[model samples]
Target: MVFKCQEDSFLKQFKTTIVSCDFATLDWVADDDNRNNGETRQLRGFNVICEDTILFPEGGGQPCDYGTINGHQVRSVQRKGSTAVHFVESPGSFEEGSEVQQQLDWSRRLDHMQQHSGQHLITALFDREFKYDTTSWNLGQSVSHIQLSTPHLISRESLDLIERQANDLIREGREVSVVLVDPATALEFQDARAPRGLPKDHEGLARVVRIAGIESNMCCGTHVTNLSQLQCIKLLYAEKVKTNVHVHFVVGERALRKLGEVFQREQQLTAALKGGASQHLELVQKLQQNVKSTRKSFQLLLKDFATAEAERLEELPKAQRPKYFALHRRDGIEVDFINTLLRNAPEDILYFLTVSEGVAAGSSAKGHMVLRGDPAVVQEMGPKFLELLEGKGNGKENNFQGKINNLAKIEECTALLEAHYKPKKAATAVEPASAS
Candidate 1:
């Protein structure tokens, strides 16, 4: 059904009589693009059907219009058969046959108009120049993209050409008009592209949007009256996904906003890199190289430290050595340190070693641990050690290894290890004292 929005397209406010009001529920789902951790929710309101409305219901790849009815906020509108249903989120109900004031969010309406019209211009230019049919398109919150029915990636030069042509036509200020034609006579217009045929509920006439000297296409979304209203167009990039190529672009104010954002990001990079925009890339690459060199030197130092620690343990007299030893590192997640220490140390002493990511101990800090000793002891201590560190792992008989997350519980784990190997005194017989 043709809507009042399609008829005028620029109407901001209108007085329309309410035809019916019924209790309804709208299931609102979070859009993947702008999701803010909001789950799907049910919105309760009255479905107020109006005699006529300026608010456009969502269809043809365009989102629904947000507006108000009698100063009550209406976040959603939908088309049911041939009627427009306005979901009014008001505690009070509207009387049927009473007049109500409907207001449009002008900024939102204008943005949609510019983008929808801009898409027609882009689709027409692509089909004319490269013979690429636009299979589908999206009108996003910040940017939009059109899917072309082609497997080959669009080149940078082709993008530049299309962008330039689109802007040139925008400057030409060509008229854009919509006309209702009989469904049987839709083919009378030459070069009209209707990928998705007419809607099933559509009865009388089919609506066709025409751009002068360009092309005519069947559409149901609201649009601008002229190409000049688009201001400008910017083609961002093209990416091939599966069988189709998506060409991303922005129109009018969105183009200006995107430019401002890019420039701001460039300024931030210049300050962080201590260089101009042109030198940012080179400076960052040099910084990365320096880090790589430093990390290698650090690893070598850790290996030397591990060797020194092993030698200290080995030098201790056999009688003076403890049954078990525990070592923990908070500097980094280098399990090789544990490996090196185990390899060089005396084999008799049980070793419990850990390496974590955080410089300071934290409950949520992640790390890895290894337990090496007698086969029986390793099997017995593996589960206890993992339980203390809040991690899951299994190990071979004499060598148990696992990943851990609770670095703050390392002290508790160390105490358990020390107690397990602690000496226990033998009890003396008391039978002789009792006989005396």
Candidate 2:
């Protein structure tokens, strides 16, 4: 609906009467069947229509203004036809015809204005300089982007030029004005960019925004009165998205915040790497090389130790051999180490091998397991081992490999195998009955 925000974009507070209040439920689920089956949750808010409001509803690629009405938090604002609906978060509804004070979250409102206006400035420059038409734009939480009608990516040189030109306009303090013009007379203005046509249901004069000697376009979003209010516009980067080139950017306070965040990250990296910002990449590369060398040496040591352990197990007398041979290695040892060790083992050996990410007492421990032995034995015990560890695996012949989550259950799994293969006590025959 036509409101004070349309006439004065900087209005932060106003008093308005409630025209209507209704209970509304916003369903989050996409499918009706899922909503009916309770698979979807609903957000309940009061849709309170105000007689007049300074709160701008979501439109023209700009987000709605968030604030409070009569001390109750306003979560969302939307426009339905000629009516502005305020979604107020309250357990009870506000009384119709009652006067309520409306307060706009000024910080959020100003941020939207800065970004929206910055987009207009940038769009105009691109169209004038490179003949690139803006197909779409997004005002995001941290950064905004405009999609240009170009299949090729925008180059750094072109972005820098546009950015410099836009900032030049900001520095000049160009006057930004909004005017209402009749549809028939709109074409009389020079270089005026109007929408193809007004919506069939749209009534009244069209509103057009003009920047001094720069651009004139039809827009419904709130904007600053002058270009200087935008502070500065920074084109961060650009990339090719399908058929369009999407340019990411930040404006005003958002640009400053982004700069601060980048500086903080750089400081953190410098401290961690013990190097200056310029030397970070080279230092990181050296650190990576060192890690690779260390890992290679550690792997060789594990292989040699596995080989020695396998030989020691094989040299044990058959009668003294354990029913089951299980090895639990620390985290970072690969499953291939188990394969190497089993290569030296006899076919009769039943081995349970595991590499854990953490100690058994901690729940986060996770790793892989490899079982090797007679096909009949593994076939009988493999499923049980996986079931106890809550794991899944596949096998062919005598070798089975899988990932396990509960490393604490490894000992229990091993005991099951040992008990199954343990030698049974011999039974003696009785001859006393024949003698009697």
**In terms of lDDT, which candidate is strongest?**
1
Query: Per-residue lDDT tens digits of candidate 2, residues 6-43?
Result: 88989988998999999986653322322455365566
CA RMSD of all predictions:
8.0, 9.2
What's each prediction's clash count?
0, 0
lDDT of each: 0.86, 0.81
Candidate 1, residues 372-433: lDDT per residue as tens digits? 98888889889988898898899998999899878777778766766666673211111122
Candidate 1: regions farther than 4 A off: 24-43, 318-324, 377-394, 402-406, 422-436
Which candidate wins on TM-score?
A: 1
Single out the weakest 10-residue window by summed lDDT for candidate 1: 426-435
